[model samples]
Target chain A: MVADTASYHRIVLDSRPAGRPTADNFRLEEVAVPTLEDGEVLVRNHYLSIDPYMLGRMSTGVSYAPSQPLGEVMIGEAVGEIVQSRNKEFPVGDHVVGQLGWQEMALSDGQALRRVDIGAAPMSAHLGVLGMTGVTAWYGMTQICSPVAGSTVVVSAAAGAVGGVAVQLAKAKGCRVVGIAGGSRKCKYVMESLGADACVDYKKHADSAALGRAVGSHAPDGVDAYFDNVNGWMLDGVLPLMNRFGRIALCGMISRYGDTPMQLSAHSYLLISRLRAEGFIVWDHLDLWPQALQELTDLLQSGSLRSGESIAEGIEAAPAACIGLLSGENLGKQLVKLN
Target chain B: MVADTASYHRIVLDSRPAGRPTADNFRLEEVAVPTLEDGEVLVRNHYLSIDPYMLGRMSTGVSYAPSQPLGEVMIGEAVGEIVQSRNKEFPVGDHVVGQLGWQEMALSDGQALRRVDIGAAPMSAHLGVLGMTGVTAWYGMTQICSPVAGSTVVVSAAAGAVGGVAVQLAKAKGCRVVGIAGGSRKCKYVMESLGADACVDYKKHADSAALGRAVGSHAPDGVDAYFDNVNGWMLDGVLPLMNRFGRIALCGMISRYGDTPMQLSAHSYLLISRLRAEGFIVWDHLDLWPQALQELTDLLQSGSLRSGESIAEGIEAAPAACIGLLSGENLGKQLVKLN
Candidate 1:
């Protein structure tokens, strides 16, 4: 009798982790598919996006978005096909992307969800290069840093979703690109695939000074623009090596997410270098998305810019995929494929 | 005898201090006035500007400019009459301001000196309000922060030379100005004299959170613009209360000057708020000085703006004045007046 019941699988927050996340922090279970209310659309998620920013939502703190409550459906974005719709704007069989959580079936009020053209790019691309990740890289690079040709540009976590796109965008602008990534494998991919001029293996370097020297060796003049994702030792390294009037776009600070607040002694250096450091969220600049998405979509289609995805199958694998992504095991954009 | 000889008094950096400086760090001695070379001018300084930046010159470190070598004449700016001139650019009896160092008489090559009109303001005003100090505050306010009318503006070390002028400028722009000063006396002067809307006594608040809460109470809507002079606890306090898209002009880090560098934990808050924090030195923006100084002069002459000075007589008193200035004992612009 139970096997005949209509149900779907979903992952929810089991408990907040002490520091780095583990599989025990998430719980997967089967629940009956809820009836779609008026003006709601039911979607069967095909792909789920697992990003570094989600780590911030898992913990209790003052973040850009509110923290995810305990024992709730894990907050995330997904690409899916609408199975049923009561809203005129979204009909059945329409492919879409929205913040639908880590669930196989999701009910949306049609406000947050947006129709995606499957012909534009792969369905998974909507959650990666052609979506928020690509838009973040574009806005942070073009709007904030605005690197000029011939200038040296540095990006931390350069093999990750946003950083991967940032390094490519900087390269397209003819700026000499340098990427900092953990381990030699990611560093190599950042250099050879991402077209960065140099790669600094942060894991090999014990301290920021060592990283700074390595960065200096590649960028003899100094980094003219910086896309900062890892804000701890990487930031300290870049501060000393930044050129006069350098611009820094703070995209993410994954390194400091689990650690105690650390003091930055680079204030004097910031003054001496006359640097501009700014922090931004993509949601704040959504107006620029349509134009940015068009460009990113073109690049992805034309093979001018490439997007790599490390995908895990099934909803149960999302937790491990996210953990692996944070630990630098994932090559590029981390995603979970669910049908 | 040495006293009867035709000599001028000058202070030199005898040794670099580990932390807080002592009188022994400076040696004030009588030296024969050097003959002016081609294109050189000899000036008898009437007022020598003593500022917080001099501490950076006294220490061996990386700064905007090269560090001042030990046992050398302490470098600084002064306003005095060009008593003798060999260069056509700087005529005799012309009042001028230049990097003439801490001395009664100085020789300049005319390249670094600029003529100052005494009728524009007082002679000492050339070394204070109408000089680099005023120019700094103006550029930091107008260029970096650019607070709009009716917005809340906060300045740390609010009664000091740069911050005092910044508060007044923000007030002139019709902004709600809040000042953070060391003591009740300076706080009172900042509020009543400088036309600031509020003054917080940072000395009374033991920690950053308390100061932040106090600032929050005054600026319930939250701080819109911050001109940061002291960069330790005060910066910690202001970072939390800053509103979305807040702008911070980093003028000086006086709090971190003598202490070991500490980590800043608010990078997360910065990302959430999407703030722009920039550090600059006025020397880099001399192109804007003429317009800024003219505006500052007009304000001072019209009594729309006020300037305060803490005069320490004689070149021998310069070291103690600097020490007192660093310790937050001096009320306003710390100047060594030589008659």
Candidate 2:
């Protein structure tokens, strides 16, 4: 069930973590359903998305979104069915996606929620491939990197949500795609299932130099465009191998989001290579979202694109799932099935 | 004299250096001036420009221009009078600027040489302010960064060739310009002579954090656009204090050029801030040169632009001058007066 009634479980931010997040940072509570106001709808969240970007919001540092306040319900995105609707636009049983936080019951004014067609695709996909992750991948690939045909494009975190989509998209565009993943299983998935030309297991190489050599073996002509997801040692490994006039679309630095003072070197490569390194937030490019979504939807319908989800069974597992996602334990889009 | 006749003196690349270049890397030679071929002109180079970009050419690494081959006439730009000509375009005594190398006399095919009127500007000024430095400043400021009026723009190496012109241009565009320079004297010149709103001495700050703090005090609202001339510590110092959606036009990485891997951190800040850093070789933007030169010429003619030169007398002093220029020992455009 993607909807429920009466009192529901919700997770709230208890305290901000100093380094890597722990289960202690979140508090699970049972709260009574709220009375809906005019133009409001009550949603029972089905699947809550736990993205790498959320790690930035849980800290005191600056991010695209405002930091989550202590004791407030943790901010997140969820695709859920409307259990009760005071608004005429969203009828009961309609699936909707919104920034509804980590909760089984969410009260929305209908302005934040967008109704999704459950018949076209899986309800959970509205939280992953058919949603923000897809849009992010499309935007980064098309708008930022814009890899030319036959050029080599490299993506980090290849088996994960955005990277997976990016690798497929590059392949679809008639470009050679290379992926950097953590383990053998993910590397196999990236190479076999995702159709990447080659996959470099970053874990197989102990240090950055070894990692660089490993990545280079796959990209003999050097990287033409890069879709960077994991930014510390992975980025260092890719920098020297980057061809002149390479474009790097900075998606996420999941390796060092919450952590401050990362050890880095690449200023000379960036300048000497005449590389264009542009850091962007997907939210900033909302105007392009609808078009991106349409293209992503068409690809999905045509079987040209594929998506995977690793879902935890309940809301109680969210904190652990998020921690596991950051540690590279979860594959694809890590989510919590809250219904 | 900045021009000579009998047995012209020239400098050649002796060997590539591992770290910082020395006088041994450059060899002084006395050779007969090449005879002007058909469609060619012999230029008596009055002033030889020694720029930071040359350091990249001296090494075997990939750069904008081809690496300087060993035992060859060192590739460089110079402005001088045409002493002899077989080309109709460049008559005798016409002052022309070309990639004429580090020599007293050069044989150019007339295509490389662009005649500069000494009546409009001084001959040496063609090598500094009214030349490539001016064009570089114009391109980076106007085309790349594109700082809006009333915005705060910060420039590093503010007393040097490109940064010096960038500050004045920013001020002329109605921006509150702040400069970062090496010594107290250079800081004073950057502020008073260049009309910068504020100037910070990077030498005074022992660390990047302290330097960031010092620079931040001048730009209370944070930097809107940055013209980065020096990379490494200075870039790290500026990254944290940068405003959201800020643009950085990377002109050079002089600090890290010819140096081994440097310690750098700020990938997280870059992503969070949504900054756009683009590095360019100005030579690629030759299409915009005529328009840029015209605008710059008008600025110079109106007395809105001021230029300075630190000249090392004679071709024998060329090696020392280049060394001094790289070490930040000389202010403004460091040139060798070879006449």
Candidate 3:
């Protein structure tokens, strides 16, 4: 018999933000956990993934994914153990990762749930490096950027999750990798820890011209490939520095997730330099996930890939963690720990 | 013997313009045509191709091609008959097309010259439908856009050279084509003459939003591919209307070829819709030209392809013709008759 009286804490979207989101937009509440039906599993979420893309879902806008519905559990990915199950494939005591939302307890019907091997890495790593974040970096680097050996490749937001992995992936391909990040500390981490040949501190630059000069000095041969995470002024700075027939993999636009429309002025360079800029979401290419995961796992096991995480203590910290990530306050993959 | 004292009238770049080019930027000069060198051939020009790309060469700004130097023969393409030949490859009376410049007579060493089949089409057609204009259309359509049979395709500047051919090419591929042109007259020609399913008159729409609505009405299913010839506000209007994974062939940016940089605000749609925007110059892909020309020739012979021309008489009219073409005063391929 299931214990239907067990209580749990979950976060819900209280209201949509006008511009940048705040902690007030989310509400934490306690509710009784529902008993699982046949073929359903009750999961006790231990780690919640806080991503830059979550900001897109918070607004009622036309995006790749539908906006998060108001007054519902805030949508996100999480890694947890199956506490109770009637499903044959997933049993109690098995670790799995899924879109379990911002809650300590979740009900799953086995769809979109992947059982994780606990022996492979820590449970929280499954929500960051071994999950969607690593896969996104792999897809953009291998599929879109495809930088040739000895060529110059640049990654924006280089200290962050996807950017950190992308920087290493480019370097592994024997490319001269340059990174762009906010502040000197993140820039140092990108160069020293992520193995980027050089890193540009975007905060130090007065304008796009100054930032472009900094990037140009680091990538003197001209950028052949750019993995873009910030697409506003950051993109503006690198566009004019691209060589003929360059490629730009549009991964994310954290800077433009706000209400104000981003103004771009370097479009003329696209034609003049014969550039190709393509945008993509990792979820759209699920077929290649297995292969990407295998390669990423190999890199991790071999110690070729290194990642950093900034963890917030409980379910209550999810909103603040998300806000910190958007403002570049987090150094790496930002996550919330909930036991 | 080669004529030593034959005088020819040619146009030269007198000065670069601060913004849009005027007739005053060009100076008509009469100079004696020198005797050909050992490997050179003299050609009597028939037609001088007036293309929008010339405006880019007129300025000192970085572009695909080097800036048109001041006090030199105005750079252009022309179809002509070899009048005197020292090179056996190009005999007298042989019709050829080359970068013969804005001059009555030109000398060539046969490096970039291509022989034209004058018997198949008019000599001037080699500079329009059968040449770079048609080849450019083929490349952007077949290579970049690659619209599926039932997909919705959009072409900007649909009454002009490249756009006109691109519209017909998309039609041949069995796509539902929509054209965006400046005036109602051009819009009518785009629909009636070029066989576009619908035409949107950008002039009627006061802003990008209104223009986007007009385009949306014609393409209810959403645009799958866009052939962008005018890349400023025109691109802005069409970008948000694109469906997921839509392709944009960045052929030219006529509106932003002036001094002022074009400001774009719809870049977020690129990432949101997972779009791929690629820029190309036909000259860079010379390897595909032969195949493209062959297909174009077959289409012309089958009466499946039709093109329009706005001809200005004599080399003296090139400057005004170029100015008129840039201002959207021309109907189709703007050319100057030299003989």
iRMSD for each candidate structure, in the order shown: 1.6, 1.8, 0.8
lDDT of 3 by residue, B40-131 (tens): 99999999999999989999887889999999999999999998999989999999999999999998998889999998888888998899
Highest lDDT against the true fold, candidate: 3
Compared with the true structure, what per-residue lDDT tens digits does model 2 show for residues A27-141?
9998888899889999988899999887888887766788888898889999998989999999999999999999888999998787888887998888888888988988889
Each prediction's DockQ?
0.68, 0.66, 0.85
Residue B20 lDDT (model 2): 80
Q: What digit string (tens of lDDT, one per residue) describes model 1 on residues A30-92?
A: 998888889999899999999988788998877878999899899999999998899899989
Stretches of candidate 1 off by over 4 Å are: A1-6, B1-6
Instruction: Show the lowest summed lDDT stretch of 10 residues, model 1 chain A.
Output: A1-10
Q: Residue A156, candidate 2: how far off, in angstroms?
A: 0.4
Candidate 3's C-alpha runs over 4 A off are A1-5, B1-5
Q: Give per-residue CA lDDT, model 2, range B12-63, as digits (tens).
A: 9999987789999999998986776799888888999999988889998766
CA lDDT for candidate 2: 0.87
TM-score against truth, every candidate: 0.95, 0.95, 0.97
Which is better, 2 or 3, measured by TM-score? 3
C-alpha RMSD for every candidate: 2.6, 2.2, 2.1
